[model samples]
Target: MKNLFHSYFESFKGLRKEIWLLSLITLINRAGTMVIPFLSLYLTKNRGFSLEEVGWILTFFGLGSVTGSWLGGKLTDKIGHYRTMVISLLLSSVFFILLQFPSSFWAICLGIYLVMTVADIFRPAVFVAISAYSKPENRTRSITLIRLAINLGFSAGPAIGGLIIATAGYSGLFWVDGITCFLAGILLLKLLHPKRAKTEMEDTFIQAKSAMSDKPYLLFILAMVLFGFIFIQYFSTMPLYYSEYHKLNEMQIGLLLGLNGLLIFLFEMPLIKFLESRRHTATGYLILGTFLTGISFLAINLSDWAGILVVGMLLVTIGEMIGFPFSNSFALNRSDGKKRGSYMALYSISFSISHIFGHNSGMQLINRFGYEFTWYLMLGFALLACLLLFILKKILLRENV
Candidate 1:
């Protein structure tokens, strides 16, 4: 028992103090991730937008995300990660509050795009910070620790968000989301300050390359974009599935989504630790995890029973647990420490593209065809992603990256 506890503690032992504080900030920021999960439902049910309208709105948000990520990367390189993160957090908070005011469809669409543009600027900055703070050997565990924090916060967000929606409605969700973001900003302001380190300066001088010119990295990004398109449907369409198809309420949808986060929190850390102990390959995990992702969607499309949904959710969560952190670490390993922000930004673009093509096209498919058809599409594409990832892994190994 003592050995087990010791090993668990050791998993978190090597990360820098900044990593710990970043994890805390991540926890606080993600705990209020109420807006996005329920955005589709909010637009449809509250604002009475059509499915296509919601899809377009989400697509616009993705467009902004792409722009923000590119610009944020440059900003992180030119200015610094700390200042970039602080500005993104505070401005995004203001945007979140402003988002609550726009009622018309076009106005709401523009508002959402702006909000996402500002908010997503934080992604690459945070990644750069993680790389800057941790040693190379412990990088994956550091990324996993951040992910663990994110899932822990997600576990609370949906569960509490459900209650807020039930009693206080959509406006309350925005208020709470905005407030928490502001608090996270204030916390960062108090805790983190500017500093110049010799190691960073040396790294900057040693590796001053552009990620855009890296071919292997481009292929890796393509693979993530493909996989992400399929994986992202859980957020974009799954809540509507629970509410409309399975006849679950907002609170029930929240609970079900919360289950995904709770499972990750319980199992991800131990699983990653075990994998690290055994010296598992990132490729092996990525392939298996992607295959499991297909099976997850398959399990549910085959049945509508609530029990089946739980089983599917469990499978998806497990796949996510295995895939995402390793992918982040893989991106980190492939980049120069000096250009970590740029590489991470490029990697983040895959998700932005997924948001655009995934949610927008997904909603269109569901509206035109049916939910089962959409699931079938996701399952088929997930298998394709697995194959692509397998090939990409060989390429990466051959390139010795």
Candidate 2:
């Protein structure tokens, strides 16, 4: 045990104090969020809204998040990540807490749309801080550590949130989520601060040259955007799909999502290590993940194979575990010194874009076609993503190397 602890601390020798603080911030914030994975259920069951109406609401949230992410990237560059994160957290909390009082559909939609903007802004800034605070060599591990905290907290949050919603109303969960935000923001405020790299004092030429010549990195971002569309099933249409096809109860859906989070937490680290060891093959993992996620929807559509859905999610877990860190590290590795955050921010945009379009569009497909057909369409999307990943990987390789 002592040897293991020593090795762990040794591995973290250069990790800054602030990054660790941000990890705590992530845990607290995610623990509080308890809302996202189950948002579809709450809106449908509590609000007496149709799945299509939920789609419209999600579209707005996605749109707001896109705008917020853009603003966050700009603000992080202009003002500071710390300041931007704090304000966004406070604002989103206010909007979330307001859900307690309740309002008409239009009013709630407007409020949620607005609040999600700030909530979206909070993510990029925190990540920018993550990139900034860590040494380049350890950037991947640090980001993985942050992801671990997020998934760890996230893993527990859904099951708890399910219980809360079962016992209390949706409003209670909103209140709890809001309070968690405030707590996370407070921790970041207390523990984190800006620290410049010593290399910043030297010539900036090194970073610029690295970024300008990085073909693989640019291609990686494009692929990430495509995969984001497929992976977004967790939020978009998957919940409704599970509910409708599998006839899953709220508790069951909650357990499935909790299991999803748990898989991420359990395998993400070792997966990252393995993927990085064969970095050249990251595209394969990307392809593999998308195929699994896309095809799983079919399994969900066909038999009442909730078990298959779980298995598919485990594939997703494997894919995400392999691809996400590899992609982030690849991006950070190739980022131009001053534009690292910008690169990350742009990569971040695709995820929200997928959420905005993927769910609503998938719903439309489902409404028009049968359930199985709609999934085939999603499967087509995933195949398209794989093709893009392959093309980009080829370019990234021959372009620079």
Candidate 3:
């Protein structure tokens, strides 16, 4: 038992200090991620928007995400990841604060679009930073470490967000979100020196290939879009289901969402370490993860017991723990040294594209057919993603041979 516990901590050993700092910045920023999780509820309960209107707003949010990711990639290539991340963090803070002022449907839609566009630019920039900071051998573990920070923050964010909403109203979420972003930016400046990061990256620079020309990678991105489409429902429409079908309150919903993050934080790194040491193919893990996620949705419809919510959430969290870190490492590995910014941008864009259609469509389906039908439909999408990933694995193997 002592040896087993020692092995768990050993998994985190040998990662660069820069990677730790980067994770710290991510933690600070994501810990204030109170607004997005509750955005649908705020629209429905406080702003009095219909589900359709909220869906439209979410679509715009996605559009902005796509734009931000692409722009961040371009900017990261031009100005370096340091500048891109710093700019994104500070600018997004302002936009988050401004988001609270929009009262009308169109205005709120526009506000959300702007906020997300500035905010999501952080994604690609941070990916490039992770690639620049970590050793090749430990890159997967580094990705897992960063994800750990994100889920840890997520664990705290929603629970605290629920309290803030209950006590101070939805407007309080925005203030906290903005302030945290600003604080994270300040911490990044204080801790990570740009010259050192650039020096590290310069040592490994190579002639870059355009990410668009990479067909296999693009196909992989498609599967990610599908995976993200199904996964995103947890944040977007599933909360509504919890409220309407399970009669869960805001605090209860927050706790449930926090549970997903908490589980991932506790288990994901050691799991990734065990999987990585086995040297299994990335797609193999991806297939299992996708299947688990699909089954999680089905679990929701299995019983009327509120305990089923916990069951479903556990499955989703497990799938995420299995899939996401390897996905990051795979995408990074596929990229050439210098143009990694562009490659990671496309990877981030896959999820953004999922957001474009996933949230609105899930809400529309729920509005039309109800939550149970939507859950079944999500299972179908997850299965489809698994099929695509299987095909991708075959193609990749053929290329290697």
Candidate 4:
């Protein structure tokens, strides 16, 4: 196992400077994201509110993130990723500090939405930077490793957030996230100093825009949006399942979340590479992953054991191990380097939109329809994505590939 680990990491032996910087940035960014998974719970359970009210607050987060993602893309197109990232970090930090004040439910919701929007600017811009810096040969592994870092950070963040929420209250999360945002900006600036493009080909903003509008890319984006629609359920609904249905406490729930992160952290690098090596079926991996997530959610109904819930989550993690990075890589790889930030921003909009719907409407789905039905709904979304991607690939082959 140790030998395999060494050999696996050897794949990244000499990546472009930008890939490493982006990995670090991804790590820092996710560390701050400790809030998202827990925010709904904190509001509903800790603050003496109901899930429906929490849903409304979470909806704002989704909407704000969507708006921010769209606008950030435009900003990246106009200014540059580095500047966009800087502005995003600065704005997110200001909002994080603002969170320290006690406010009404509506006010808190507004703050959540605001920070979610402003803070999220880094990802697309960083994607732009990574695409700008890497060559096609190393791109898949490069993106995969970036994901590796993201999960590694996320691995720690949720577990830590659970601890902090228990000991320090929601306010503590704000302070930590705020400080991380400011430092993340500084780390990004220091690590990924923007380049003036040694050649015209170095930056591809206009080319990216043109390419993004292409049939294959647009269809792929649609698939991703649906994929996001299903995936965000993990954040919004899965917790409610563990809490209300499983009868688990925060500490136990935190362990499951932590275990989810650990699997991604420990196994994702090898698992993604292993999948990639068997065939060049990025689309297929996505379908399989999404299918498994739906199946796994259904499987949760089979057992009430918290340990079994971990088993189900492991399945979900494996599914993500196959799918999410595959979709991200495909979208970013197809994008032109200079305009990668904008392209990813738009891609991110699909994700943000789903989160909005997932948190707000998803709670309603659970409330009105029940948890099992929502999982079934997520399954349908995944199956739809599979069919769409298969058809889209066929079209791409005939038309573009």
Report the number of the highest-TM-score candidate: 3
- RMSD (Cα, Å) of model 2: 4.5
lDDT per residue for candidate 1 within 262-375, as digits (tens), equals 777667777887787787678778877778888888999887678888888888888888889888888887876547668889988888898788876887899999999888
lDDT assessment of candidate 2:
0.70
Worst lDDT window (10 residues) for model 2? 197-206
Evaluate all candidate structures by whole-model CA lDDT and list the values in order. Answer: 0.82, 0.70, 0.87, 0.74
For each candidate, give its TM-score against the true structure.
Answer: 0.86, 0.80, 0.88, 0.85
Q: Write the per-residue lDDT of candidate 2 for residues 1-401, one digit (tens) a residue.
A: 79755654554456678778888888888888888777778888877788778777777778888888777766665556677788887877787787656556777677767777788787667776776788776677788888888877877788789888889878789998998898887776677743442233132334334322456555565566667876776755777777887789888887887777777755566555555556555456666666666666555556665588887677666767766776666665555465554555666776778777766676677788867787677677767777777787677667668
Worst 10 residues of 1 by lDDT: 196-205
Deviation from native of the Cα of residue 201 in model 1, angstroms: 6.9
Is candidate 1 or 2 superior in lDDT?
1
Candidate 3 C-alpha lDDT tens digits along 1-401: 99888977888899999999999999989988679879989999989999878878888888999999999888777777888899999998899988999899999988998888898889998988888889988888999988888877876788899999899888888999999999999999999988965763453355457688888888889989999999999988999999988899999998998788677766788898889889898889999999999999999898999999999999999899988988888898888554777888999999888878887789789999998898999999999999999999999999999
Question: Candidate 3 regions off by >4 Å?
Answer: 1-4, 38-52, 102-105, 161-173, 199-206, 239-256, 299-310, 367-373
Name the better of 2 and 4 by TM-score. 4
**Relative to the unseen true structure, what is the C-alpha lDDT of residue 241 in candidate 1, on a scale of 0 to 100?**
86
Candidate with better TM-score, 1 vs 3: 3
lDDT for model 1, on a 0 to 1 scale?
0.82
Q: List the residue pairs that clash in candidate 3.
A: none
Which stretches in model 4 have alpha-carbon errors above 4 Å? Answer: 33-52, 158-173, 196-202, 205-212, 243-252, 298-311, 337-339
